[model samples]
Every structure is written in structure tokens, then in C-alpha cells.
Target chain A: AQSVTQLDSHVSVSEGTPVLLRCNYSSSYSPSLFWYVQHPNKGLQLLLKYTSAATLVKGINGFEAEFKKSETSFHLTKPSAHMSDAAEYFCVVSPIAGKSTFGDGTTLTVKP
Target chain B: EPEVTQTPSHQVTQMGQEVILRCVPISNHLYFYWYRQILGQKVEFLVSFYNNEISEKSEIFDDQFSVERPDGSNFTLKIRSTKLEDSAMYFCASRDGLAGEVGELFFGEGSRLTVL
Candidate 1:
């Protein structure tokens, strides 16, 4: 079984400040991890994915995440937060190709 | 870019009525999935389909829930009897299944089901 835990339910940051969202996972085997963002009333958009290729993955909108195996963590980070970045983010773990487990989600609020 | 699309953005139904949610996945995608999220809750996976059969499903997908790919393009989820608890936003997602491809899912806007 694979599961992901998002440490924070909500996080607020001022514009131009660094942003961090924490996630941890438990999987039986080497797993595939992903970060997805969902805006209000919109579908989820893939931010980035870790497929055991790179320890640090860069994604769109200046977002990035580092995959740490020992710590079982894949935390999303951005050098600076923008108002457009305010949304709900999910950490997902997949044991196989099609099945996925999503974290509770972290609501990000960017204040201008 | 090609994207998944869902129909009936919102539906209101009386309890015990059957509701079917429809989706059209990306043309070349081979894997299809259904997920649901209650208001303010985490998204939950309901089922995954490949080769016109279910590959995996969650415990929440009970006897009352079923899925089908009736045609080449349409994927549908049918709930036999709706309950108030079933009210949520149902999302349909698809993934390109090329071997060695990363497991990235493309999602539809979702259908909001309201069981009254």
C-alpha cells in the first residue's frame, strides 16, 4: 500500500516570500511521487513528478521539489511566492502505474 | 494541448436515484481513472480502468458503484443508488500508458454531484 501525508492543512505567505509545503510518504516499494495543484473550481494540474530519475525535480511556475528517500519526503518549494500560486496542493504516491493515493492537501494562501 | 473533458458540470438528484457521470479522456491515453472529493476534503481514488477492464479500485467503490468505457472515447461512472454522502466533485483522469512513461495523470474539470 502507498500513502502520502501533507504536514500542513493551510499555509499563508506574503508575496515574494519563499514557500514550502511538506509531504511524507509510506510505500512498500520504490514509489512514484507527484505534486499537483488545484485552483478553485478547476481541475488538478501536475506540478512535478519523481520517477527515481532525479533527486531534485523542477516544475513549471518556478516550483520545485526534492525527493529524499531516507526521509520518505517530497517537499515542494518555490523561491518566491506569487498571488497566482494560492491554491490547494496535493502530494501523491503511486505504488503502480495507474493507482494513486493523494494526501489530505495543503491550502496555500498568498498575500499580496 | 489535448485535455480530458467531463459532462454535466453539476447535477442534483433525489436520494436513491441513479446518476451517471461522463468523461472523454485524452485521445491517445490508455489509462482511465475516477476520483472523488467531498467539499474541503482530500481527493479519493475510486477506480482505474485499462483495456476496458478495471485494474484497481478502492474500498469506497462498493457494489453500488460501477464504471464502463462504452465507446472508444467515453468513460462513464454509474452509481446505482445515490446517498447524501455521495455528493461530491467527481473527477475523471487519464494517463498516457507508454511503457516507461512517468505516471502523470491529466484531469477533467469534474462533475459536481448533489444528492438531496
Candidate 2:
């Protein structure tokens, strides 16, 4: 089965600084990857997704990620952090065009 | 921009009591799904439904768990006997049957279940 692993349980970044949340996956086939953000007391919102089409996919709120087949990773990155970006981020993977398999999740804290 | 919707943001029930969580997916969506997160645990897929039948299910979805799309808009998950361990956030999600295509599953705010 396809699965995802988030390297960090939590991450803290200062405003205007770069942010990185690491994620890795194990799949037999080229998988579909996604990043979702959820604030406290709110529903989850999709950040970005990487299908087979693009290696580097851009997402909302200035977040982006690169699907590296050789590295087996799809790490979420941001050039500048904002206070509103503070939320629980989950890395999910799906079998080739299949249902999503979510990771344990990484909580992001942005300090202004 | 139609989205999935879930009912009863929070429900409190006693152990052994049956609880049904309701969901209304996007109007044109064809596939429905149910997932659960046991407070701080990973999100686990419970079951996937399509064409008014179950297409897939996980081991966690045992005999006690059941799903049904009673009418046109309502998708429901029913637990025969609730347990304390069942107290967690149950999320309802849906996809527009674009499997071979490029659409992702949209999730609802989730129904928080608390078994007392």
C-alpha cells in the first residue's frame, strides 16, 4: 500500500523567513502527492498537488513543493512565512491516481 | 465552487449507543468517502462508496460500521454500538468520479464524536 511520512511533528518559523516541511513516501508506482493545511477549529484546505504532469507544483498562500522521484520526497516549501500560515499541515500520497493516504501530520507555527 | 458539507459539528453519545453522522457532498460529485482521525492519530480511510454501493473498505470498518446514501443528497455513516475509542473526529469527503483524471477529494469540516 502507498504511504507517506512526515519528518517533523512540528516546525516553527519566523515571519518573512523561509519555511520547509519535509515529507517522504513509499509507493510502488509514481504516486500523486498533496499538501493540505488546516487551522485550528477549521476544515482542511488543499495547498497543492503534484500529479504526473509537473514536478514542481505551486499552491495557494505562496506554498510550493517539488516531486523528486530519485529522492522519493515531496517537501513543502515557502519563501516567506506569514502569521496566517500557521496551521497543521498534512502530507498525503495516493497510489497512481488513487485515493489519498495521509501522514501523521506536521503542525506549523509562524512567529511574527 | 460547490463543497462537501457535514452535519452535527459535534455529537455526544454514551457507550453502546448508535450514532449516525451525516454528509452532503458536492452536488455533482459521484463518489463518497468516510475517514476518521483518532485525536492526534493519522487519518484512516474507513470506506469508499460509489453507485450506491461500497467500492472499498478498510479493516477498521468492521461489522459495527455501516454506510448508506439514503436519499439524493445525504450520505451517512452509522455505528451500531459506540465505544469510547470511537470518540474522534469523523470526516466526510467526496470526489467527482474523476479518478483517471486530475481532481482531488474534498473534505468536510468533520463531525466530532464524543462517547461518554
Candidate 3:
């Protein structure tokens, strides 16, 4: 079985400040983890993915996430938050053959 | 760049009415999936289709729900009878790769179904 947990339902940050959204997962096999962002009324866009290649993965729009094996965590981070960064982010875990499990999502609210 | 496309961006229907959501996945993609997200809720997997048949489905995909790749370039999800609880944003996604190969999924904007 595979499951994902986004620790924060909502995270508020001021523009130009650091941003962090925590996520954890449990999978039987080596999992493929992904971070997706959805703007209001928009489709889910792939931000980045970790397939046991690099522990630190960089994504578009200045976003990045580090996969911590010991912690079983893949937390998204941005050096500086921008107003356009406000959106809903989802953490997903996909096994080798089955369906992917999605987290409840974290709403990032960037205040200008 | 190629992307998934869905029709009926938003549909409103009365309870018990049938609804068919359509999608055109990226050409050359082999795996397809349907997912839904209720208002302010997490996205949930409904079903996955590969090679013209259902490869896997979640419990939420009951007898009332059916998926079909009736012809080339079109994938459809039919609800024999929709309920108020069925109102949600349905997203269609596709991936191009063999099993065990890690690939990112391409998603459509989603069809918002409102069951009254």
C-alpha cells in the first residue's frame, strides 16, 4: 500500500520570505514521489519528481524539494516566496504498478 | 507541447441524469486515468485505463461508473446516474511510458460536473 500525508493544510507567508510545505509518505517498494501545483481553476502541473535519483530535486518557478529517506519526507521549499506562488500543492506517491495516492493538499497563501 | 484535453469544461445536470465526460489524451501515451476533487477536498483516484481496458479502479468507481476508449483519440467516463455527491471536478491524465518506468503525468484542466 502507498499513502501520502501533507502535514500542512495551509501555510501563510509574506512575499520575499522563505516557504516550506511538509509531506511524508509510506510505500512498500521504492516509490516515485511527485509535487504538483494547481492554480485556481487550473490543471495540476508537475513541479518536480523524485525517483531515487537525486535527493535534492529542483523544479520550475524557483521551487525545490529534498527527499529524506530516513525521515520518509519530501518537503517542498522555496528560497523566497512570490505572490504568484500562492496556490494549492499536492504530494503524490505512485507505486511501480498501482494507482498513485494523493495527499489532502497544502494551500500556500502568499501575502504581498 | 502536447497536452491532455477535456470537453464540457463545466456541466450542470439534475440528480439521476447520466453524464459522459470526454477526454483526448496526448498522442502516444499508453496509460490513462481519471481523478476527482470535491470542493475544498483532496484529489481522489477513480480509475485507470490501459490497452483499451481498465487496469485498476478505486472503490469510489462503482457499478454506476464506467470508462471506455470507444475509438482512437477519445477516452470517456460515463456515469449511469449521477448523485449530488458526484458533483466534483474530474481530471483526466495520461502518461507515456511502460510499467515501472517513472514518468510525469499530463493533466487536463478538468470538467466540473454539478449535480443538482
Q: Which residue pairs come into collision in candidate 2?
A: none
The better candidate by lDDT, 2 or 3, is 3
Deviation in angstroms for A7 in model 1? 0.7
| Two-way DockQ contest, 1 vs 2, winner | 1
For each of the candidates, the C-alpha root-mean-square deviation to the true structure, in angstroms, is: 1.1, 1.3, 0.9
> Which candidate achieves the best TM-score against the true structure?
3
Model 1, docking class: medium
Lowest summed lDDT across 10 adjacent residues in model 2 chain B is found at B95-104
Worst-scoring 10-residue span by lDDT in model 3 chain A:
A92-101
By lDDT: ranked, best first: 1, 3, 2
DockQ of each: 0.73, 0.59, 0.80
Q: Give the lDDT of residue B1 in candidate 1.
A: 90
Candidate 3 is scored at a TM of 0.98
The recovered share of true contacts, given per candidate in order, is: 0.73, 0.47, 0.76
Candidate 3: where is the Cα deviation over 4 Å?
A: none
Backbone clashes per model, in order?
0, 0, 0
